[model samples]
Target: MSQDHSQDHSQDAGAALAEGRGRSAGARSSDQAPSLRPSLLDPLFAPARGLPGIGPKMAPMIERLLGTPERPARIIDLLFHLPQGGVARRLMGSISEAPPGEPVTVGVTVTGYRAPQAGPGKRPYRVLVEDPTGDITLVFFGMPAPRVEKMLPLGSHRYVTGRIDLWDGHRQMVHPSRIVDEAGFAALPAVEPVYGATEGLTSRAISKLAHAALDRLPVLPEWQDPAWLRQNGLPAFAEALRAEHKPDGPPPPVATDGTVPATPARRRLAYDELLASQLALALTRARSRRGPGRQNAGDGGLLGRIEAALPFALTGAQTRALGEIRADLGSDRRMLRLLQGDVGSGKTAVALLAMASAVEAGRQAALMAPTEILARQHHDRLTAMAGPLRLRLLTGRDRAAERRATLSDLAEGQVDIVVGTHALFQESVAFRDLGLAVVDEQHRFGVHQRLALGAKGQAVDILVMTATPIPRTLALTFFGDMDVSVLDEKPAGRRPIATRLVSTDRLDEVVAGLGRALQAGEQVYWICPLVAESEYVDLAAAEDRFADLQAEFGAVVGLIHGKMPGPEKDAAMERFAAGDTRILVATTVVEVGVDVAQATIMVIEHAERFGLAQLHQLRGRVGRGAKASTCLLLYRGPLGQVARARLEMMRETEDGFRIAEEDLRLRGEGEVLGTRQSGLAAFRLARLESDGDLLEVARDDARLVVERDPALRSERGRALRVLLYLFERDAAIRLLGAG
Candidate 1:
């Protein structure tokens, strides 16, 4: 669908003006007339000033609590802010009848008073209250005496509510939360809603502010299907919000009371977020599908040569993945597929086959890596694999004359397969007939960079490869715009890595074992925790370890870290690969793209500090060789419960897919995807850990919805537009231009 450029320009202008309104509060000229208007989301997203009781003082606190720098908080954020638990204020009539350590409300009479030591540094005030059955002391430390006297005077009847505690055999309330007179006490809620509070902000303040904000909530049209709502026993949007914001004592179940059960309100909000994400992904997919693309069905001659050159036969999973890629490239629609495999799972070979197919079709193909080292690695591997087929490498580190020669060859169709870093997208680089673009470690590249590579050719088919095994739900959320294929099995001759957990306290023992392994001519990787030693603290550094190991093992040991020059790192890697360096002490820089088939032993120092996924990736480094590899997880003693469980899980299985699921369970989706910038969705209410089941439902529902309303022009689609806007997914709606 082609967007109306003029309307988009107008909308952009309106959004700018609406944003400017926050800075230029004094500028008001009704006669000037508003040429363009902000959407409903504009007002809903306006600063806290737009909400009642959210004055300048409270807005900053709200921002801090929400962890956002955006001036105003969105209404959707408030709706999704579900309570963790609740406090009950149900009345028990008398202090004696109230359960100990439980919150209760009671009507009592002020029978006496005891003033504490007055003046500076004094406790100040205390009040004595009595019911027909019992008397409870109210202690107020550091409170003004006059205020306490005025509020709870002698013989005054009042209702008091708070936690009842026994102090030195005396029943006392540290602070009587409510000490209202007869008339004022009648107006107090029998059951009050408690909210999460920040410093200088009490629960009562939040409740008051939330109630005021709810009052200003505009009635929105139903965005969920009526039948679905009825089947799920969910209330309307406003009703659900109201129900969730108000709770009775003892907290309700997650279903009904809105505080505990899977309340309709929480489900509604979760579904809204899911729908917005799905809609955006679907729209992006649709736009890409509409773009012009070429069908490049390559001859199988070059692919045959590459297959013959392989040391071992391709696994069934690898073959299936290659077939999928070939089918996608052969189709008219541009391929945007994610090739996910575990470390050493043969993703590189699969990528090479796909590129060979493109080359055989008389079209150019480019493989882009995340870093210069990885790019150089890929270049070397591809050059060897496609040497008989004549592939070329172009990287940033290339000499000036060499780069010119490579670019000219690329422009003149002398290069069939080009491998490089992001430099592949530079203007000087041109493809003779670029058909496919393969990106390694897809998470490292942004959407714009990936699109730029695709833009280098007219409808270049995109194939992204990642060593990280993404959970199914996150795959749908993050890479929903693309098709996905998993390389589930290792190729023939691949060995399973034997993982072991060891205490770091036995450093001497580990070093002795490494010495024996090195004597046997077995390659070793002595991974260190830090790149360098600090003055304030001591930790093993890769360089320091390299020197120490060299003193014992002679020149057989080498060091590599991020601080080393690229050429130096590459040389170190080459020496290790060529069996010259028996021991390579390095940082986590070798975690991802570094591949050495002979390295059999892997040691990770301070393994407790690494996440499950990182641990899995690091373990993968040693298992590539035919000799049975062992991953020694050198953890510090006294491991925490979670860390112990993570290490045990790693030792239990070598399944990357299962490890990915456990990682998601232990470390949430946010951390599992690396940083927030990994393009993982930031959920407001739904949690991938607790809400894993909901993700499947949401994914299916989203796919079904898009299938029915591709353009999102139906009534349900219109309602979904409100959902998109509500979740601040208006960008997805704008893509459709449905309005």
Candidate 2:
């Protein structure tokens, strides 16, 4: 670690981290401004290797910590590396009371020196230093004896900082971290920002480099509202960075539960990043889906007939969602709406009704699923609820003649709706006048793919669905560009699932329970984490469990996994769905949109291995029908704190939204299943778990800014443009009157 000799110029170093932006300039710039890079930012973007103190040997190590192959470590990138926390340079009165493993600054008198052997192995040049309480040995390795003597002449006074070690039954400090006179000790920072240092490079070195980087920063225009800053008691961008890097006082306090208070500077920087992201999304939404939309609303003929034939009435949430969709469909602006519903919330029904409206408008609609089984399930479910609307199924595995027939019928407008996987995106698949496109589990597809599907027809409205219930903060963070419609309520009479957490020591008892469940004529879903047995992970496998269950229950058991052939997988699922097989042992391949209301029992092996959202989804497979269902979470014992918390949570509640929020609290955003893959901006400075409250303010500010200055010609509008480019949201700036 670099010894902290002084804290002269580190104000801007930590400030640079306020906007944790990406590396590299974009491939193109806006024509309206022509030159995207202002001359002020050029120095900040200079390579780290070119910095004052960084040399050839240490440059690669810095790059390894910060840079990727696409971009070398730059001065700005070093600033992005924020300190983890502060370490106080505690001063001690005497050696007797000094903690053995803690850093303490102490005054001592150098007494005498003992030299190593002439030509040697492992012997050090040991010097004796004495305080009033006692004397200690300070050993220096691989140093010239004459130099060591000259540095510390007989009876010289000095201040030493570093830990004291109990080496060979004596108090010795090997190479005291810093040995300086009274002046250097006085210059030391009270609290040092602790960087996450790697081998060779120290936090001290990083701090100095950040200080150097900050010197290049020019006074920039403020993009935030002055009133909001004062109300929140937050600092400006530069002031925040300075406060973070230049640590003079004791560190900020952390809560008892390990929550760090968002110090004004940290909050300021986080708000900066959030505002940039929100503004970019607002600009894109303004330029794209706000244009004149196709009028795809029908006369409500098909929807009325379908509702009349329905077994149960739609929930209020579903009704409200449908109203929103209808309003978007009827408006002159194209619809780009996100439908977030918990498991078994009747989103499928709402989507079908939306599609039916398009059919009534004499325009065709298409639904795309992430998997073929899900597509088939949709086709089956929609066919039952579609009433007079014509529908066709398309897949890559279809026979040549039948596939051609389906395509020809679709192009000739013979089909009202087509359900398919990615095959529907093929060049050969043509639609007569595709009006509305519905994408299920949009996390599996990128935003560009969703738009590409909409591009197949003129002004095609897009409605994306997700079975995973995302917390509101994540919904805004990921789907901020689209209008949101939430199906918050379940259909009436939806069965409540009884979730049971059982230990694996009760294997025989669980099997016995399974036998009882089977004798009751209820179907079961047994989920495993792996497809095959492996010597590495000792978790249960679908194939082994399938064989064991099949032997015990005869031909009533079916097996399926991701590795199975498409047709074989289909057959296995069909057998289980049709009740030909009472039990299906499969991997998480069945986690998505494979709906079977008849299956009322879910047995997940190694439940601790799965996340909260996955466990909730697997449980959802059972509680869809009227009969009270049960979800058995089979886990092995000796659980970690997180695992035990997960199990207790699974047993406590089945509310998917509550479970989703808790999941984020437990495993954070990255490990919370499919959330991070939603094709949104990956945040470097702001974490969704803590900074979520600021997101709404940023979003509102962005919307108002876009409303007032659509072309970004005003002074603050131009500054907002810089914010967009700094955060690598350049696409939004390009949409700003490029011609």
Candidate 3:
């Protein structure tokens, strides 16, 4: 499956450099040193010094918006800051034609003025104007009467525009939005672009800055295919940008424009961004292919042992995914694959199978989890499953002597499988013959961390797993570099969790149901939205709920919030798992990787406050065993339309992939990825919801381009490099060791 494309790349790079040298010589002879403009992508693009009117005071605000100080402001950033809406101005030659009771423009002559009652707290000036067809009043609440009179004296012709109403069947325009004379009217645009503003910023300021930045837009060669441009009826890049920044009216959907379909200018901008993304992914994929990988074929002995020890047989989907992983591990090419399965879909089992393969091959394998609890859970499960095969746990919480012994055994290749959190990647932990690295909850870790774990072995095969079933559109965009194995089927023995929606007002009823369930020897998870009640407002808190439930249910109710000490939290979880606690009141700390087969009832308080994926994950905590399960999504009264829809969607299906798509549609990509620090790409131009088709196109284009020119030595590729730098995907560039 591996190709030798690097040879072609090396030859092409040599030819490109030779041609560039000849051009450099010609430029020198012509007395031109060929502007070393840093490819318009140097770190300088981020320094506030490059932008006009961005003083020290404004720099901080820009930094706050961008969430970074290294990149301050740039001409391209401003151009990409798309407008949110547009304000269309109504134009009428005369007030006679202006429709009453609607926003209209009227040409009037100022005739008289009325001053507000002259007091400290009184309204200020009111000016009266009469047009040839009607009369209107302009009221300024704060302006001085003398100043207002001077500005619009008698017989002053002006075009006043605002909402007009009829009082006693007479046309009246209150608080005119614009008071423009003939000359001023000529300068006013019929339509104005309205941009989102921050605390100290105004839409006017944003428009001015955008205009200034647009002026600096360099006339570059078009990068899009001409055939695409003609067939799509898209304007040139510059024209599209101009239309977007100074839209005549509210910008139409991408379908109306024919180019990119999110926003007019943004869609064009997204195309460029997607091009850069694809280019970088292609380049990185190309470079990874260059790194020689070992074929670690393994005997089926250890795998058979682990599978035979399992209580249930593997589902068809799990078997298929495990087969895919085995095939990948046996291949000469490196195994950079993603294992995507729904929560409780037995992704961990698939990962275990893969790890067992490495172990059967006389090599070591390591599994990394995002959290200590998850790591410990994996360790416990793997230790039980790998008993016949022999595995070790190297978590941070392990005793010093035990950890030391485990490290020694790991270094000596005595440990078949090592399960831990990030402790596995620490310098102290060494694997004698590491063949595979399996990472759980892959999104929690960054690419660098993943790479560090992979680099632990001599080009180890990597199997990254995620319980969050990402929408296909986002999967291709984010995980395009890796082979994807989707576990779409749930195990046959798994029962559907009966989902119920309840209003928070019926808490007593829900609590009564929980009491009944607990009395019946069924375990319950009483999840809250927040860990603690805020002083400013009262909200259901996990601690408070634990206290309330403990009073009623006695010592059987346990609390496990993030704020608790690690040992205390682990104790609480242990109590719940061992059935010592019938009720576990907790926060989102148990959102992912916490598996309790006996917990059959889940009560999510203020479920509307949770995202669809989170709700799905919380619900997954139940229905693990054969017994029927129930999920009570207890939401507060008066849910917003979106929250209501989310609750309904959750109640309708247990399919994680469908829920994920709905979550994307409801919460958008930014919120879906969580806060800015999640290392998720916050695309300024591309909307994952709207531009999904473009994402698909970009992914395919990237794969195709890489197949054709792995090193980006082609002419089109040089231009694409500019795109990568522009979109901040330059991290992929460094993978080539080129820059």
- Indicate which candidate wins on lDDT: 2
Q: Which of the two candidates, 1 or 2, achieves a greater TM-score against the reference? A: 2
RMSD of each: 7.2, 6.8, 8.0
Residues 1-739 of candidate 2: C-alpha lDDT, one tens digit per residue: 3121111111111111112223224122232233356565666666777888888888987877766555566666666666656656657889888878655667889999898877747779999999999988999887888988877788988888767989878998887766777787778888767676766776788888878877776677888888889998998887887777777777775544444467888889888888887887787777676567889997887788887887779999999999999999998999989999998899989999999889889899999999889999999999988888899999999999999999999999999999998888888888999999999987776555676788889899989999999888777776778889988888878878899988889988988888998999899999999999999999898999999998898999999899999999999999998999999999988997788888998999999999999999888888877788999999998998889899899999888999999987877655565543332324666667888899898889999999999887799998887776555565566567452
lDDT of each: 0.74, 0.80, 0.73
Judge candidate 3 at residue 86 and give its lDDT.
56
499 Cα displacement, candidate 1 (Å): 1.9
Residue 480's C-alpha lDDT in candidate 3? 65
Residue 236 alpha-carbon offset, candidate 1, angstroms: 2.4
The per-residue C-alpha lDDT of model 1 at residue 273 equals 64
Per-residue lDDT over 1-739 for candidate 1, one digit per residue giving the tens place of the 0 to 100 score: 1110101111111011112322222212354333122354444444444567777787766655543432334443454565654555556857788877765778889988897864667574778888879888999876787888888888888888777899999999987656677787667664575556666565666667666667667767677778988998767877767766775435553332123445567676666666666666676677677777788667788788889888778899999999999999888888889999988788999998998888888888999998887888888877777746667777778999999999999889888888888899988888888989999987777666777888888889989998998888778766777889999997777788888899978988998999899877799988887888877756677778888889988999988998999889889988989999989999988889788888999999888888888888888888776688999999987998779989999999989989999988777776775744343334656665665666667667777877788777788877777776565454555557632
Ranking the candidates on lDDT from highest down gives 2, 1, 3
Pairs with backbone N, CA or C atoms under 3 Å apart (clashes), candidate 1: 47-72, 253-260, 253-261, 254-260, 254-261, 254-262, 255-261, 255-262
- Return the lDDT, model 2, position 432: 94
